[model samples]
Target: MSADPNPHPTEPDVRPHVYDGIREFNNRLPNWWLFTLYATIVFWVGYWAYYEWFRVEPEGARSVELAMTRIDAAKLAATAAVNIDDKSLWAMSRNPVFVDAGRQTFEANCVACHLKSLRGKSESPTAIGPDLTDQIWIHGGDPTDLYRTVTQGVPAKGMPTWGPVLGPKRITEAVAYVLSHHKEGEPIVIDTSVSAPAK
Candidate 1:
């Protein structure tokens, strides 16, 4: 026979002995999709190398330092600025300027926790701190005791250091306002039902 010059690319070289038509293809993958898959693999490898492998020690040290700093500040706020003398608080309360400052400070900070009435009642369910109106003082009721409590704070009870946060003059004002709870022109009144008599 003469050499077969025409060849059909679609037709397979081997013909099946029996007749049931099924075919196979040796198709190549699309170039764009294959490139995208390779790029994603490269990105994941680079990310793992930089963040997971390289900076572990430095990151750990930074976290530890932050934790220690927070603890120390809590300790200082709980313990500093305490003198434990009653007269000191009393003296501080007597000053009008100090009392006014105290009033302002109390309004700003304490009212949220202690209530505007200063009675320390019905506002907080558990009474996280103490009742200012009542005579029973935990740390002490005297002016000095009050000042110490106000400035240094009782961290165990979640009372923050107003002295550190605010300053001396503001602390004085807070004491004054607390002292004026029963008196006139105070920022908050325990019982507004009874009107104040003419000055």
Candidate 2:
């Protein structure tokens, strides 16, 4: 048989190994592709250094905590800005918006103890809280007194301090809702002789 033609090609780029009648060639990658690979590596290093090593920015939990703190501060500022008094509370009681918001808050939080009718012991003798609809006030009957009771709470009487829990706006709204059940000029008799309902 005659010698095989072109038994070994002289192309410098071709590798010595062959598989399935195919020869591998060592070619330079496109400039754009090389540039992209290098860019990605550089970007990864920078991102890791900035976020992990250097910690230039606050992490997720810390950022959320900061946001919550700012929100709380803003809420306090807003609460302070409002003129909260007997007259203002009475006015809020008359306002449909305030009353509605108060009702919602009361239903969510106060319904457990006070019951839905705003009459606790009156509605059911087994209720844990006293009647709010009655003219006789256990804590105090004035609008401001009611607001104070809600905010400060009566720990001795098993009431949770709602000021820090509900914030000022929500407490105000809830008090307004309670006040909506009574007339402004109605008689408010203070009866300290009445004991807190047994829980």
Candidate 3:
């Protein structure tokens, strides 16, 4: 037995346990960190149980299932609300609600391909997508054409169909916006002050 309480002569030991010749130190983690770790583990376990076993929570997370549900819900809502015919969408060109919604949707999703300015990246050798600010559409500039284009997408051209991802409401809004930008002087019938959709 040595005079030193620590068996190892050189190293100042912090932990009780030691392996072969190496000393193990118990650098105790902060209370907040330990608490957070434990809390996260508990939360994960609860989430798994609630989502997987009981199925209590709604499908709000970003997943294929949620997207599909939203699409279906939008379709059903559309069926109940309006006819959504080509003329109707074109008529909504001046509606700020639809135009703004479309713009937001475009900015959120289309910006990656279409660029932030709605203009195609001129610096790039190959164009990722068309310059939306321009009127020259590879597909026709009609509202119905835009709607179909957005719904079905030009997959080969690298445009992913937005119908499933964004739902019909947003697609309709986008169509209206595109048509408004395409041609000049459409009826701006929507009353901005009105709380509900104008009949």
Candidate 4:
């Protein structure tokens, strides 16, 4: 093989590494690439120092504990700000949106026990739960009574406490939906043949 007659003298004297007759020149990387590599290393060091060493509290970027505290505070504030009672439930009943939400919530959550028609279960009508369409309620026929019965369920009886399971807003909607079915002065008589368990 003939040697190159025009070899640059300023080029590095470092020998080229050869593998399978392929030569790789030991050249310096481009300035931009080297600058970028250095910049990243410096950025990483600065980032580590700023976050780990110089952390500020309550005002600065929140730590995990501070974030959690703020979240809990927000929860407390929300609970305090929103007041839900019998009047609210009654008020909510008039709203079509709330009624729809309640219906959906019931269909999703309560259908297992209360069934689709808001009466007893579709399979065993009278055995599982009472008919909600009927004006008669074992736990007084008032909005407050219904709220109490639903939120704080009767453990002694088979009913579950749905208030915690479904949040207060949901419970309010549910109560409204249930009460929407109630017709005042509507007479309902259960069979005297068998005393079914209270729903």
Better of 1 and 2 by lDDT: 2
lDDT of 2 by residue, 1-199 (tens): 9774554557457778999999988767899999999999999999888878999987789989999999999877998876689999999999999999999999999989999998998899999888999999988899888888989999888888998889888888999999999998998888877755544
* Candidate number achieving the greatest lDDT relative to the actual structure: 2
- lDDT (Cα) of model 3: 0.71
TM-score (all chains, Cα) for each model: 0.44, 0.61, 0.49, 0.56
Error of 4 at 85 (Å): 1.7
RMSD of 4: 7.2
lDDT comparing candidate 1 with the true structure: 0.66
Lowest summed lDDT window (length 10), candidate 2: 4-13
- lDDT tens readout by residue for model 3, 1-199: 6575666757665677668977776556899999999999999999988878798865446466888888999878875684467778877877888888888887788777777666675434365766665655566555676778888897765679887898778878777766666555333332234223334
Candidate 4 residue lDDT tens string, 24-59: 666678999999999999998877777766743333
Candidate number with greatest TM-score: 2
The candidate 1 region of ten consecutive residues with least summed lDDT is 189-198
Give candidate 4's TM-score.
Answer: 0.56
Please give the TM-score that candidate 2 achieves against the real structure: 0.61
Candidate 4: lDDT of 54? 75
Please give the CA lDDT of all the candidate structures.
0.66, 0.89, 0.71, 0.74
Ranking by lDDT: 2, 4, 3, 1
